[model samples]
Target: MPETTLRTTGIDHLVLYVGDIGRSKKFYLDVLGMSVAHESPRHLFLACGGQGFALFEPRDGASPETDRDLNHVAFSVDAGTYEEIKAHLEAHGLEVTGRRGDDRCIYFRDPDGHRLQLVVPD
Candidate 1:
């Protein structure tokens, strides 16, 4: 075995498997305020700040299963804007859960049952 150090940067993109690409795309774009970087019939690329995310439609009729206890995606937001964002999500009919032990985070789920969080850095 060879000993070598592997250096890597931050996440470039994260792909989420969705049953309906169009509905997922609209949720990300309209709710999260992400911009569309690219799109196709089966996939959508959305810009998140400097990084990006992709929505992929599975050919099979099954949707992706996310572990309720551990699987989730979190995005950062300004501390001042935290309350406004939470309120917006609620106004849009999404259930938002405040962190049990922390005051700086909220959890919610997307249309595809993917858990997502909005967090404010201290």
Candidate 2:
């Protein structure tokens, strides 16, 4: 550990590259009901829990299919809401593909194959 380090509060934003802007826009903005905070020619910033959830397409020759991050994004939810969200995804024909060891957290993938999770506080 460093004696002095950067004082970070929280994530200001997160950027994810997707295959198509229109398709990812529909999924995050329409399907998941994330409200748009801002937009550009390619970037769409979503208002999520006081932080920015950004989705955009690669415009500078980077391929989203081959040059994207290999990880998942997780969001914390209340117990009841967690259950409700899982059910909601199921209603949309999505399968719960995995779970945490505690079982209070569930995992699934988005339309673009990005893994996402919802967890309840212990």
Question: How many clashes would you count in candidate 1?
Answer: 0
Model 2 root mean square deviation, Cα atoms: 2.9
- Model 2: lDDT equals 0.76
TM-score of each: 0.83, 0.78
Model 1 over residues 23-95: C-alpha lDDT tens digits?
A: 8888998988899999999989999999988888877776565553348889887544667777899998999
Candidate 2 Cα outliers beyond 4 Å, as residue runs: 1-6, 60-62, 66-68, 79-83, 99-101
Query: Clashing pairs in model 2?
Result: none
lDDT minimum window of 10 residues, candidate 1: 61-70
lDDT of 2 by residue, 1-122 (tens): 66767788989998888877777887776556688899997888999778899988888857777335768898776445556776777987778865545767878877778888777665
lDDT of 1: 0.83
For model 1 the TM-score comes to 0.83
lDDT, model 1, position 111: 90
